[model samples]
Target: MTETHVPEKLKAPVLGAVITVSDRCSRGEAEDRSGPLALARLAEFGVEVAHPVVVPDDIDYIRSALQEALDAGARVIVTTGGTGITPRDNTPEATEPFIALSLDGLAQQIRLAGLAATPLATLSRGLVGVSARGDRGALIVNAPGSTGGVEDALAIIGPLIGHILGQLSGRTHEVESADE
Candidate 1:
């Protein structure tokens, strides 16, 4: 597979993880597409992706996977699936406790992008945030369950991820916008 060259000049050591949340997928009743897609996208940006994991819609299981990934030195954990309004859609709720700071702008930006494509985007309920797990920090982003939704979210997220990683790692060379 060809890796997509990042636009930024410097490639920092960005570690990442992808979690797919789906009952059927986890039970081997259905194939997991979102997880692999997210992992591939992270790889394109030169991130060292930890072993991908898939869990059911259970909140406790989701939280466990998240904590394990963060403890393993993953700076970015993107979760796909379970961000909708269905009875089992509880990813956003499950993720709330881990987030030290909410990255509302990212969630909104991704939703708006998805909204342009389909009205279902408004109901995705995907959440994004920063988690200060002990001395380290990680950016946790929630993506929709569909393969296309994950692809659309990645199109907007991929470019900005480098900056987020730089901020998390305290990179002094970071270039901020004039307004900031």
Candidate 2:
């Protein structure tokens, strides 16, 4: 018998949440551009934004917000800010417990690409992982605080979103041409 190869296409509806982890933003003292930027970027991919929130940088606060978004049915959660080396940056620590699988390669790629523009990008200690809490699954990634950094991360992951969603939904067909 000969083995046949088949291509896969994503059918599951993709929902997203954007969390801006900044104390001032949560307090309404600062405007949130990162969360909105994430929402806009994901919108181009046809992913619906389910919950967009601004939370304090406290570890527990960020963790609770993430849990809330996940519970609200967000299949992808993109977080900005609080991933640096500063004392107040606790997004990474807060998200550690909820992670099911860490995608180090994706995180590394983001870092590598960002490094070309600014050395400060190397200071980011952001992470990417999957959540084990839901039946639909969620991919959680920490994007840099800067607008350019966010753009770089989005560009790097944009093409992969559909493929990732397809795998998560168990679809098996080619949805777009390689030229896309």
Residue lDDT tens for model 1, 1-180: 334444452266578899999999999999999899999987777667866699999999999999889889887889999999999998999899989988898899889988878998989888888897333788889999888888877876777777666666675453445565
Residue 134's lDDT within candidate 2 is 39
Predicted candidate 2 versus true structure: per-residue lDDT over 1-180, tens digit per residue: 334434332355577888889988899998888888888987776668854688899988889989988898887888899989988999899988878888889989999999899888888888887885335778888998777777877887766777666655665554455555
Candidate 2 has what TM-score? Answer: 0.84
Clash-forming residue pairs, model 1: none
| Candidate maximizing lDDT | 1
Q: Please give the range of 10 consecutive residues that has the lowest summed lDDT in model 1.
A: 1-10
Name the 10 consecutive residues with the lowest summed lDDT in model 2.
1-10
Model 1: residue 74 alpha-carbon error in angstroms:
0.4
> Listing every candidate in turn, what is its Cα RMSD in Å to the true structure after a full C-alpha superposition?
5.6, 5.0
